[model samples]
Target chain A: MRATFMYGAGDVRVEEVPDPTIVQPTDALVRITLACVCGSDLHPYHSMPTGEEGTPMGHEFIGLVEELGSEVTGLKVGDLVISPFAFSDNTCEFCREGFHTACKHGGWYGAGGVGGAQAEMIRVPQASGTLVPIPGDVDEKLLPSLLALSDVYLTGYHAAHMGNVGPGKTVTVIGDGAVGLSAVLASKQMGADKIILMGRHVDRTGLGRRFGATDVVAERGDEGIAKVLELTGGEGSHVVLEAVGHMPAYEQAYGVVRPGGVISRVGVPQYEDAPVGFGSLFGKNVTLNGGPAPVRAYIEAAIPQVLSGEIDPGRVFDSETTLDDVAEAYRLMDSRTALKVLVRP
Target chain B: MRATFMYGAGDVRVEEVPDPTIVQPTDALVRITLACVCGSDLHPYHSMPTGEEGTPMGHEFIGLVEELGSEVTGLKVGDLVISPFAFSDNTCEFCREGFHTACKHGGWYGAGGVGGAQAEMIRVPQASGTLVPIPGDVDEKLLPSLLALSDVYLTGYHAAHMGNVGPGKTVTVIGDGAVGLSAVLASKQMGADKIILMGRHVDRTGLGRRFGATDVVAERGDEGIAKVLELTGGEGSHVVLEAVGHMPAYEQAYGVVRPGGVISRVGVPQYEDAPVGFGSLFGKNVTLNGGPAPVRAYIEAAIPQVLSGEIDPGRVFDSETTLDDVAEAYRLMDSRTALKVLVRP
Candidate 1:
């Protein structure tokens, strides 16, 4: 089967790899229908290898269950489902608390030598908990948005929830990519009174505004925070969503939140030693909460909105290509030419 | 008026200073009935000018309102009150949200050019917010413990509250000073089932046990955390109270809290930067909250316990001396000769 593999940094290729089969009794073999590049993928794409071996890329996907292991329950062959970026048993104490990402037995696909979503068929561990049957028949046209619920949209929503974004909250979103844009939408859904989207592009900024960004700051670094502070009456936003993982964006998120506010970083930190400055964070009495989003937790509610056409997150897919063009898709994403690239398998 | 002043690292003296008078419309002159040495006072007492102007000391006190400014309301002369360490207006939005320490016009006492509380008469700012009226007269002998609620006890309670210490939760307290001991008491009040007091003193540890610490670990640093983790089946405590303000204690707080748990630090970090390695905090999704305690918020509920003898934090004051013996008191506390020293002016 043709699958995406990283030969090296900036060297993602669609190569002939063996098709995945259900090896564990609790696993399900899923045939990928749609997959999109995640912001987290860019980490390995630019930096040194994250794993000991060459890795498969991509974790966000919507797919059909091609086969199910004997131990798998609540799922059947030929069913369309959404798999959370991280696999969990969904029955653990942590998962019971809606923190599936922190499940005792939870693990990540496309990471730790496991094959990822950018494949013809992938074996999903703990399938009963990993796969959420799609609400209804999902058209290929809406696959990108549904695929988004598997990771980015839910992550944005999780960031909003963690930051306590709600009515009358003034939120500053630091990052204009799909996750950041999704946060704008989620903040609106959660009734944030004002949202300042910080970005460097006009097209994405416009999309951010359309998705409920009450204001946009095109400046970078301190200037962006200055604009956010200005918009929030100099006290800074009540909640700041850090959707871009880096020192600068993280620092900006810290700078723009009001005292006793929150800075929720959904952007996966690329470095092992991410310095979440406690001194600055402590002085402001701010709360920092972030990790892999509990995508399944939000999917049950988010999928309905996407299915009802209430939200059109698919508009984020500015480029679309076939599995054969997966290499160029990776290049386009690496070169920042695409907001999001959808790949059809 | 007589005031306790630190002449140098080891030199304390009772000396006459300018009598405090109401400087702001919101200020009141309080005749301090009781004042206690705080752990924070040790910081400057150990580092102040060797032979320069001696630093005035003390920030925690219970006093009788001897004079009121023209604008003061809700408090009157002759009323006994508990003065929170922080002077805040208490009517701001932040105060309404129960974070009076972050009130818009809030100011801390004793460290930033503010005169010390170890004086016969001290000026109280934002009197309406900073001073809580004592419900009824209590025995003068109990003043020491009641005075503790003005700072340390309230601070420990705040730490426990911020860390979400509650029923069935396991809590690890990182410091066994007055505040840490007080936290053991507070955690019990909050319904925490398993409380571990990590201290090195037999006397303080005994007091901690009486105050509801179910376990005690005398080990320090990494060894202390290892003991805590071992006791908790390697998952670490559900809530960690960092009551010692130092790099090592802060690191221990981070090292011992379980994933998705909380670490509350009420100990004032004297360093310009709170040296925290966020790699662990971020990965575990720990909620860190601490600062100056908002005692005004808790005094109303805590006074009854103090008066009824249900909780005697005053027992922490192992020694009492005349203001003339200020030097001896400083030395005793600095050398850990006393858990707390109460001085009579």
Candidate 2:
């Protein structure tokens, strides 16, 4: 089997690796049909590694189950499914509370030293909880969007849900990548009255509009907040979805939400210390909520929408590359030329 | 009129001042029937004034409406009412959102150069919105508890509300002062299954138990959190109400709430910059909420309970003195000789 590994920053390679096998009664093995590079991958790709540990390179994927442990229920061999970014038992207290991403025994598929998804096959623990079976056979063309349901779509959905974006809400989405575009779609589905996408790319902005962004603000930071505030009649957006996992975007998200409104950021802060304003946040009574999306919880609803042609998040895949070209995919995504680069094995 | 003024730290004097008169169309003159010392009062009483201005001494009170401004409605002269610590026009966006304390035109009665409730006659702006009329003259015995509803009761209620305390939930209230004791009562009314009061005093602990505290832990900091976890079977409390405004108490509240639980605090942080652990907070998915209690919102329900004798929070008042003994009242409260002190003119 071949898998993608990061030798160091800006160095990604697909090489032969040991095949995955069920090591626990709760584990299942799946043959990967599709995988994609994530924006979060760029964080380490642009920075120094903590130590000399081999790091896996992908998390989001949809594949066919090849084998399952005897303990696994509700799933079997020859089944197509989507695995959420984080694996959990789904029966823990956190799982019951709808924070499966924070499941007590849950761990990230790739970032936690586990094998990455951009491989010929992958091992999924707690299979009954981590994998959601597809209703029917999914084609290769539907792979990008289905793979998206694994993380990006769920993250975007979480952003909208946490922000309480619904009917009559004016939502603002910061970051014009796959997650932001998915957020625009999710916000519309949640019945947001208006959605303004903040991005510099015309193509991405166009896709945002198609995905239900009623307006677009090309500026960043203070300028972007100014435009959003202006659009909202000086009140600012009622809900803000921050998909960019950086300090500037987080600050902008905080700045543009109306007092008493909500700011939901799915952006994974790169730094250990994320600076939050206690004074301003407390004074305005804003609700800040977001983290790893409970993708498994959202897959049931989002998959139906995608299969019904009600939403086509596949448009977010601006480019596609083979597993051998996984390194190029990383470069294209890091350069911001591609919102998301679908990887085919 | 005579008023209590804090000239500097440890310097409080009862001095003669002109009687307050209506200064704005929304202002009403209130003759203080009962004014009490607050925990926040100690901030200026023991430290330099925040601004270079005359320091008025109190904000909590039950008063008689002596005069109404031309624009005042829903209030009449001779009406006995409880005035919230902060005044706000109920029509503003913030007020409409049930955050009257953050209203655009809101004014703090005692802190920002406005006359304090400790004075014989105080001018209250936004009178109709800030004053809740009490039913026909209450007995003198119940005046202290009713006066507490003006600020302490509502503030404590806000904490419990922020924590989402309700049926089948367990709540831990930090601090055993008047506000913390009131929080126990509020949690019980909210139907919280269990209430734990953490403090180091026997007198207030007894009062808290009487006010519906299910358990008492006289430990401090980590030990207090450890006891709370022990009480909740190592899962931590479902809600934590931080009634004491300090870093240690805030940290303890954070430590004692289970993941996905809420931490509602009404203690105003005296420091300009308070650092919080975004790492632990974000990971736990805790809902941190709080601010000044929207007393006007709760007074409608709270006042009736106070009037009916279903709950007597007035037992928290261990000392009652005349206006001439205001200095001594402060002394007793500062020395922890009284849970709360009520001053009469």
Candidate 3:
């Protein structure tokens, strides 16, 4: 089977890798139907530490189950399904509490030298808990949007949910990446009255507007904060969705959130320390939430919307490539030439 | 008038100070009827910066309105009122959002050379917004508890509220100081079924139990976390109230909170930076909320509970002294000889 692997910084290649097989009674073998280059994949693609062994690379995918182990239940061979970025036994305490990312028996794809989603075949542990079955045949046009439920859309939904974004509230989404754009759509779906997208890219911000961003701030840092505050009548937004996980993005979030509001962050943070002491967020009574999205928890609820043609998160996939062009897909996404690149197996 | 002033580290004195007068039309002078040494005061009392000038030191007080400027409405001379730790116009955007501590026109007591609450009289700015009038006060025994509503009780309530404590949830409160003890009580008021108090001091933890701690974990750091996890059947508490503001307290909070739970911190943090990146909380989807209590927002709702004789947070005040003995009060609290010291002028 062919899989994408990063040889080193700024290096990506699609090469033959051993096919995955069900190794545990709870495992299921999935043949990838669709996969994508995620923004987070760029983290290591940009500067993964040198000398690390090349490994299968991808966490989001929609596939058809090819085989299942004895213990797997409610799912059978040839079923169409979506897998969250991480696999979890949904019955764990954390999973039951809606924090499937922290499931006791769960782990991230490709972690610990395991095969990942960017492969033709991958083993999904805890299949019954990790796989969300799609009933009947799914439309080819709906593939990208449904595939988004695996990570980006669910991640964006987590941000809005954590931020408590709801009717009559003003939401400011920072970052113009696919996740940020998805957050704009999710905020709109959550009934936010005013959705503000903070991004400098004209093309991305234009999509943001189409995704229901009522306003756009094309500045970064202090300037962006000023514009958001100005747009919010000098009070700042009631909920600030932090889709970019870096020091600057977090600083802007803290700067633009109204006192007593929440800043929901879903970006895989790049920095180690955040100044969350008395001088920063404490005095304002703001709530800081968001981490890895409990995508499995949201996938079920989000699917109906996509199926009903209520939302088209697939718009984020501006470019499409095949398994052989996985390397090019990464390059295009890294350079921002494409918002998101859909990869077909 | 006499005021408790910190002359240097470990040096506290009650000295003569000029009487307060209304400097603005919005100001109101209050004669301090009750004041208590706060856990936060120990921050400077233990090791104040060298070469810093002496400053009046107290933030919690219930008093009689001694005088009111012409523009001070809804309050009059001789009225009993409780002043929150910070003074705010209570009409600013932040204040309107229930974050009075961040009010544009507000500032903390004893800050910037201003008068503090541990004095015979205090000149409250934005009196209309800063003072909460008590309809009628007769019993002197209830003074300590009512005074607590100004800061400690309100702060505790804020932590519980921010943590989203409710019926059937398990709550773990860090710190056994007055505020922490108050949090145990607050958690109970919020209907937490199990309240665990994490503190090392027998005397303090004893008070915590009286307040509403169903269990006590007499350890700190990792050991404390382990104990809490064990208590909750390895699932961790649903709500972890951070009543201590130091790094270890926060670490314990993050360690003991269940995935998807909240860590509400009310401690005036001693550290500048917290690791809020993926390694810290994002993976667990834990929510970090609470800062300065926004006491003004909570005082109204909490006061009714205290006034109704349903909760006696004043039990935290184990010792009593007069204004002349203010220095002694600090000594006892600093040595942990007193959980809390009530002072009268």
DockQ of all candidates, in order?
A: 0.42, 0.42, 0.79
Residues B1-345 of candidate 2: C-alpha lDDT, one tens digit per residue: 999888887778888988888888899998989998888787677885545445777888888899999999999899999888888888887788788877778888766557888878899988878888898868888898899888888788888887778998999999998899989998998899999999889989998998899999998878888999999988788888988878788779878988767777777765433433346455666666676787877788888888899877777788888988888888888899987888998
List, in the given order, the native-contact fraction of each candidate.
Answer: 0.26, 0.26, 0.89
Off by over 4 Å in 2: A111-113, A271-278, B49-53, B111-113, B271-278
- CAPRI category for model 3: medium
Model 1: how large is the Cα RMSD against the reference? 2.2
List the TM values for chain B, per candidate.
0.94, 0.95, 0.97
- For model 3, residues B243-315, the per-residue Cα lDDT tens digits are 9899999999999988888999999889968978777788778899898888898877767777888888888
What DockQ class does candidate 2 belong to? acceptable
Q: Would you estimate the TM-scores of all the predictions?
A: 0.95, 0.94, 0.96
Q: Rank the candidates by DockQ, best first.
A: 3, 1, 2
**Per-model TM-score of chain A alone?**
0.95, 0.96, 0.98
Reference-based TM-score, model 1: 0.95
Q: Please say which candidate is ahead in lDDT: 1 or 3.
A: 3
On DockQ, the leading prediction is 3
Q: List the lowest-lDDT window of 10 residues for candidate 3 chain A.
A: A47-56
Q: lDDT score, residue B163, model 1?
A: 84
